[model samples]
Target chain A: MTYCVGLKLDRGLVFASDTRTNAGLDNISTFKKLQVWEAPGDRVITLLSSGNLAITQAVISLLNEQIRSSADTSRTLMTVETMFQAARLIGSAVREVRKIDGEALEANADNFSVTFILGGQIKGEEPRLFQVYSAGNFIEVGEDTPYLQIGEHKYGKPILDRVTRTDMRLGEAAKLVLLSFDSTLRSNLSVGMPMDLLLYNADSFTADRQLRIEKDDPYFQKLSQDWSDALRDSFASMDELEV
Target chain B: MTYCVGLKLDRGLVFASDTRTNAGLDNISTFKKLQVWEAPGDRVITLLSSGNLAITQAVISLLNEQIRSSADTSRTLMTVETMFQAARLIGSAVREVRKIDGEALEANADNFSVTFILGGQIKGEEPRLFQVYSAGNFIEVGEDTPYLQIGEHKYGKPILDRVTRTDMRLGEAAKLVLLSFDSTLRSNLSVGMPMDLLLYNADSFTADRQLRIEKDDPYFQKLSQDWSDALRDSFASMDELEV
Candidate 1:
């Protein structure tokens, strides 16, 4: 299981992913699920994946492979003209992985499920965020819906739903994403940290701030503590059930 | 989809279940998932069901039928010697439902899944809580683990994890459970309002405080407001990424 979130605010895009991956209680491992495609000032694309590790790794490899070949492949995330086209290229990569690995996984009684949140900007285009489904179809985050989450999403959703809107500042949005992740990490064992956080400032067309937040990182630790305290105080202040 | 949580505290037990049921995005109806089988001063047993509504209803019907014929049968929830025996009776009821309806549901590609959280106490026995699975096997909540959740559980898990401990008071535990439900309801549209809340005081041998919280209830409205405000404030106070 995994938890990843992408928020495309008016100021920029914020992406966060947990590093925990588990096949069972015994076979837990850390796998960085965020991949960055940067071509300096030309384009910056970040991919946050959650689902089968093999499938996501394959998708990333295929993207990198295309970037390496650079001959017959006229379409790559770095060369794509628009975020929409880049999303299509990613969808194709996901479909390619499904074509190669779906059947054997089905035979073993496992559903072929993989999903991704692809968000970033091209040199000429504005920052955009998309949630690509297991079927390879995708939806862009609109003005009304500025954030997307995949994997173990529900535990952290209430805070996002109540606190996030389309016009939040980049720093505020980043804090919300981390707080949301913090909520999920506290509750769920499947989602562990040393989180990969990427904050891109719009029109800068570069990865402005990318930080790996560890479990004991002061900011995150404080966020977790303060959030817990706030929740308790909020709960206490509510009118007690008269029954 | 539904959200239900049951907590076993030193003082007693708390059980809460949402009433919304949806077959798809277009079809949603309100149906109570909380059921009580109480002989007042002698015993007070509450059952919260999640998963296939038909199967759960069948199981409840079977239990009720047994209660009607208690004059002939030597065992029922009321006559059960221990809370463990009460769990087995509930499991047996689930298995009886599977025996009747499992195969046909499989023909439609639906899995035979129904889970139950049964809690409370008989006059002579200590209070206990059990999570009865689809296979009719159940596990009792140990002292180390004080709570259990079934059905769309993840979204609301963080608050419960952070707030619940072995030494928590019964009233405090009840408040936290409500906050947990609020978190889940905000995140997932499938789980919704008109929730069933039951809190049993320890050794009371009967349930005296049960609540049906509707969407517009004053206390719930206030709690939801405070939770959102508290979350936003906490997010704002967290330090920004130094990068």
Candidate 2:
């Protein structure tokens, strides 16, 4: 039970992920689901993961190991030549974790599940966002639908379907994204706060505009309260079915 | 593969069910998911069902047979003194269907699944609402929630969560209910149009106010279009997150 959404706007990419993970209702804890790899002026790759925490953390650790290893400077995410290559590298990392743990998890009737949102830029290419699956396959955001979401997605989806466009301003899109989170958080208990939010400006090649939203974050509180009031007002304004 | 919602409001109850049912992507068909049994001035009961069409149809057929026979003079829905008894009758009908088909379905690796929302009243009781599960257990709507939904419910739930209360006007609540369906219809392929919608008034004990919304229904079209515009306008009014 997690919710992470990434929007590929005309400006850049906006990524947000909740911090709650639970093995069951009673065993809940906070964990970072957003992983960032930035090599200033060269590449900026961001990932938001969901599903079995152990698998996601393992996949992230494995990717970090490759970056730390002196043996493979040619092909870590930081060295990937393009955003497409970075997505492929993430796919391989997931498959690597699956190879090691999928069988044991299956025997226990626990799914060997994990999914990721991979977004950012590598020099010479435009900013791109992709959703990578548990099977190590992926789909990229297209202009017609310039956003992707994973985990507890349905409650937040209708708003995105209605409003998301490729040309939205980064701040405007961030506002919509948080409203989406507001819908999800209100409906689902498993997806809780403080969320990690990052707004990437295309071609910046740096991940500096990131914020962590706590439960009491004043701006989010105001936005959430305002959206609720607006929805009620809007609902009241609609003509009731008269037939 | 279906969406049905039943809301218990101050006035009475509201029920809406999509007509689409599918066995697979290639084998989809339109079927009536809302069943109404009314003996004008005696009782008015509406049942909205979801899950294996076979099971639900079988359950309804069994209940109809009992009413048609001269044998069950005391306990048919028309004769039941309270809405609670009517709910129990529906649950027993479900269990009878399972007794006959459960093992066969399980042998074929199919689930013996069906759920229903039963809402209405008999002569002696106030309007009531209940959700009957596959195992013949049921839950009555309390004042705290006052509504129940089954099948592809998440996309439609947030709006209900935000706006539903025990004291809403029947027409206002009906507007909210149809808007909930609009959200589901936009996101899910298996829930489609020509929906059966019924609104009951307390103490009337007659089923009237029922309307079938065809795909080309002008009022529905206007409502759907208006909702989208209203949402976009509402989004515009909300302040953007500045952090």
Candidate 3:
């Protein structure tokens, strides 16, 4: 299990993902689930993945391999003309990984589940976010629903549903995603730190604002403690149930 | 889908359940999921159910018939001498319903799924809460986890995980349960009002504080609005992410 969220606000895109992976309770490990692709002034793409780590890593490696080989520059993330095309490239990679591993996984009664949230800006396009399914289909975030979440999403979703908006400032969106992650972390053991956060200012085409929030990072620690205290205070202040 | 929660506090017990039932997106209707069985000063038992409306209703009807027939008093809720016994009786009723419907439902590729949270007091015992599974097995709320939730539980669980405690007051527990319900209501269409709430003071053996919170109920409306506003205010007050 994992918890990753991407918010597409008017000012920019904010992404966060926990680095915890477990194959049963005893086989837990930390592995970064956030991947970034940047081509200086051309494109800046971020991918947050959840589900089978092998499959996600395989798909990501294939994409990176394509970029490294540069045999088909037009089809790679660095040269994709639009975010939609980049998402398609990712979907294709996911399907390719499935074709290679899905059958063996099915035979073992293991799910080949993998999902990704891909968001970024291409040179000539406005910033966009998409939730790419294992089936190689994808859906872009709509104005009404400006965020996409993958993995262990429910515990953190209410806050996002209530507070996220397209017009929210980049800094506020970042804070919102952190709070969402905080909720998930408290309730679920499968999602743990350190967390990877990426804040992309629209049209920047650079991955300069990425941060890794370790378990003891002061800001994350303070934010989580403060949020918990605030919730308790709010709950204490609510009017008593009359009935 | 449904949402029901039970809290066991030092002062008493609190239970809440939403009433909406749906077979699919198009077939939605109102149906009560909270049922109370009391022997006045002898015992007070409340059951909040979710999953397979027909199965839950069947279980409840069987229990009610058992109480009415009086043929085997030992097997009825009114005759149960302890909260544990009451839970077992309810579990038995569940298994009985499964025996009658399980095969037919499975043949149609339907799940005979039903789960329940039962809470109350029987005269000589302390207030108790149990989560009854479809298998007719159950687990009581322990000191460490003073609450149990069933159906669409994750969305509302963070608050309960944060604020609930054995020492919390009945009023605060009531508020927490409502807050939990509020979160579920906002995120899930399948769990909606009107909601039934029951607050039982320890050793009282009577459910005099039961309330039905209708969609337009003034207090519920105000609480929901205030909670949303408070959450937004909290989010606004949080420090901005530096990275």
Candidate 4:
């Protein structure tokens, strides 16, 4: 019941995540799914998560614990010189969470689940993006595939498939992601308001554009309204099947 | 897997279904998913199905048998007085199939699943559409809800949400259906080429337009190509998020 999308474009990376999570319809709550680890000019890493909140929280807390513990942890994400190593650190953290809670979650018939979109710069390397799956394995964003999405992904997939590419501008991509999220939120009840959006400029090593869109945010309201009008206009313009 | 969409517009109805069905990745085949039962100017009932091939085929076979015995059998789709009765007949047919094959399928862990989009006109009634679920119960389309889609539905849902309304022109609605199907076919391997598309004009009690679009069909190819381009163009045209 979440929709989070990360785009790796020529400019840098764009991340968007809806804040709604629910155990059931009546148990709905808003929780920010984007976590930023900023060492300012040195490194800036953002983590966007989906799936079971418990598992994702465990993984994030464990990673933060490592960052706090002596700062000399060999495979720590902040200390890692390359994006690939940061990804490995995330995978290791996921596996560590599984080791502690996987069996208990299975006992309750809740299959241990966690998926993440990890994107940022790590001092020495260029900004990169990766999607880590439930099995703790991961894949990087290639030029041909410039985006990654998790949670209620299908409702938002068509837009991404049709529009995104390597040469896409980060700003345009950010709007597309919001539009995609808007469509999903309209169709699905599980993904709701109060979304977190972040735009990172490659090699800037600083989160340049970040916005928290609440339920009544003016920009999102306009974007959704514009989309509806555009769709209607486009549909009206297409030649009909003569019946 | 399959993708079938049925739209109930003010002027008439539109139904579209993909032809692909797969037992596995390597065992994919083309099987027509749209079934039409028409008695000239009397009734024109089109049923678009998705889910287990065997179960749906069984339902169709039952209806076909009834039609074949129309001379003796009083209950047939073409002879039905109301769209409601027609839905019940289809539901009864579904339950009949489940009565015969539900347990063995369950034993094999194959969920007894099949859903259908039934839309058309019976002489006495206005154009109506219904979505029949696995349990054999069905819900009729209303003015408030103008469209119903089954199977791999999410990939194509955004456009429908944005554009479809009670006041849309039949032509515009039909084009929207095609775009929705195009989006679905692009993203999911289970939904594929050679689609069955039928458009029923109100009060005609017969199909006014129908086309079977194949992979090499010129219009379809053009539509698919144009849609992707239209999407990219829309993305570029939208004002970028100022970051």
Candidate 5:
């Protein structure tokens, strides 16, 4: 299991994904799940993946392979004209991996489930966030629901449901995303960190505000501690149940 | 789908269960998942069920049928010697339902998955809490982890993890449990109101302190609104992310 969240605020798109991957309890290891493709001022795309590591890595490799060949610019992540087209390219990449490996995985009772969060900007269109399903179908975040999360999502969702808005500033959205991670990390063991954080300012068309927060990052530690204390206080302030 | 929680606090046990039952997104209705059996001053036992409504209702009916027979008091919930024995009785009831319906459900490609949280006090012993599984096995909660939840649990779990304590007063625990429900009802469609809440003080040996909170219950409406506001404020109080 893993946890990754992408927020499409008016100011920008903010994304975060944990680095932990495990087959069993004892076989845990750190692996980066966030990938970025940049054509400098032309386009910037951020992708975060969760589910079967082999499948996600294969999809990423196929994507990178397409980028390197450059023979079909329309199909490459770096050259896709719109975020919608880029999403379709990813969907095709997933189906390509499925056509290769889905059956054997099914026979072995190994799941081929993989999901991706793709969010970023092209020159003309605004920043957009999408949640791509294992079936390769996808849905975009909109004003009403400006955030999307994949993998181990329920534990951290309440805070996002309450605090997130499309007009939120990029920094404030980043804080909300980290707070979301804080709740997830405390309750679930499958999603561990040092986390990969990416902040793309809307219309900037560049991936400049990115940070890799180590497990012991002081700011995260302080934020987590403060959030916990504040949450408890808020809980305590509620009226006592008369019944 | 349903959401039921049982907390074993030093003061006693608190149980809450939503009344929603659904076959799918469109076929949803109300059904109580909380059951109680009491022998006045002798013992008080509360049961919360989650999973297939058919299996749970059958299990409850089986338990009630046994209670009605009364020829063998030792095998009945009212005559159970200890809380552990009471848990065993419920587990056996689950198995009885499985024996009757498991194969038929399997043939239809339907699942027989069901779970239960049992908590309360019997005479001559301290309060005890056990989570009974479909396979007639159960595990008790201890001091370290003082609460058990089943069915659609994760969305509301973080708050329970952060604030629940064995020494919490019954009223305080009830408040926390409601806050947990507030989170669940907001995020999940399968779990809804009206909710059945049961609070049992330690060694009370009677089934009392029960409340059925209707969908339009004023207190619950106020609590939910207050919690939403307090939570947002708590989140806002956190520092802006440096990144």
Candidate 6:
């Protein structure tokens, strides 16, 4: 299981994902779920994926292979004219991978499943966000719904519903995402630390701020401890229900 | 969809349930999910159920019929000697209902599904709480897990996970449950207002503090608004994550 969130704010976009993956209780591993593609001064695309590791990894590799070979540069994410086209390119990759592996996975009672949150900016377009499903279809974030989440989303959703807004500052939005992750990590064993965080400023055309938060990352530790303390304090201060 | 919670605290037990029931988006209704069976100076048993309304309503009616007939008092919840026996009686009621209606429901592609949280104090035993499944098997709440929730549970779970304790005061516990419900109500359209809340003090043998909070209840309105304000305040106070 995994938890990934992508937010489109007035300033830019923020993406965060946990690294833990488990096949069974006894077989757990760490894998990075955030992938970044950038052509400085031109475009920046970020992808956060969850679900079947093999499918997500295959999709990422396919996209990377296209970028490395520089074959048909016009069709790659780096050269996509808009964030929507980039999402379509990713969706197509998902479908192409499913075509090759879907039947075998079904025969073994495994699902050829993967979901992704794609967000970024092209040189001429505004930063946008999308949630792509296992079926290779996707929905872009709207003005009222400024964020998208996939995998183990319910536990972390209340905080985002309460605190996230289009006008929130980039730093504040980053804080909200980390708090959301903290709630999910505490509630679900399948989601753990060593998180990847990327903050993009609107029209920057580059991911200037990216960090990998490890188990001992001081800021995350402080944020987790402080948020817990703050929640308890808030709870304590509320008046008892009168009945 | 529904949302119901049962908490086992040292002082007694607490149960809260939303009253929304729906067959589809176009077919929604309000039905009480909390039921209490009490024999003053003897026992007080409260049941909170979630799942297919037909199955749950049938189970409740069967139990009520047994109470009305009084032909088998020894086997009824009213005459049960222990809380465990009360849970067993309720479980039997569930299985019996399934025996009668399960096949027809399955033929219609409907699940004869119902789950319950049974909590109360019988004359000779300590207060207890149990979660009964569709198969009529049940598990009791333990010291570590002092709460059980059913239906749309994930959105409201993080708060209970953070604040509930076996030794917490009943007033504080009530506050916690309401906040948990508030979170669920905000995130899910399927779970709505006109909630039922019941608090049972150990050895009381009667539920004297049961309240039905309607949409216009002043206290609930205050609590909901105050909780939202407190949470936003808490979020604002947290230091932004340094990028």
Number of the top TM-score candidate:
2
Per-residue lDDT tens digits of candidate 2, residues A3-117?
Answer: 9999998889999999999989999999999999999999899999999999999999999999999877569887889889999999999999999999999999999889999
Chain A TM value for model 2: 0.97
Worst lDDT run of 10 residues, candidate 3 chain A, spans: A70-79
Identify the runs in model 4 with alpha carbons over 4 angstroms from their true place. A71-73, B70-74
Better of 2 and 6 by lDDT: 2
lDDT of each: 0.86, 0.91, 0.90, 0.86, 0.90, 0.90
Task: Give a tens-digit lDDT track for model 3, residues A113-220.
Answer: 999999999888899999999898999998888889999999999999888878888888988888899899988999999999999999888999999998998988
Chain A vs native chain A, TM-score per candidate = 0.96, 0.97, 0.97, 0.96, 0.97, 0.97
- Cα error, candidate 6, residue A166 (Å): 2.1
State how far residue A188 of model 6 sits from its true place (Å).
0.9
> Model 6, chain B: what is the TM-score?
0.96
DockQ, all models = 0.61, 0.80, 0.80, 0.66, 0.84, 0.76
In model 2, the clashing pairs are: none
True A-B contacts kept by model 6? 0.81
What's the residue-level lDDT of B58 in candidate 5? 92
| Model 3 bad stretches (over 4 Å) | none
Each model's Cα RMSD: 2.2, 1.1, 1.5, 1.7, 1.4, 1.5
Predict model 6's lDDT versus the native. 0.90
Top candidate (lDDT): 2
* TM-score for candidate 2, residues paired by index: 0.98
Tens digit of per-residue lDDT, candidate 6, span A103-160: 9999999988899999998888889899999999999998998999999999999999
Over B1-243, each residue of candidate 3 has an lDDT whose tens digit, in order, gives 999998888999999999999988999999889899887888889999999988998999998888899566456888778888888888899999989999999999999899999988988899989999999999998888888899999999999988887888787788888889889998899998999989899988788999898899887788889988888998889898887
* Model 2 regions more than 4 Å off: none
Per-chain TM-score of chain A in candidate 3 equals 0.97
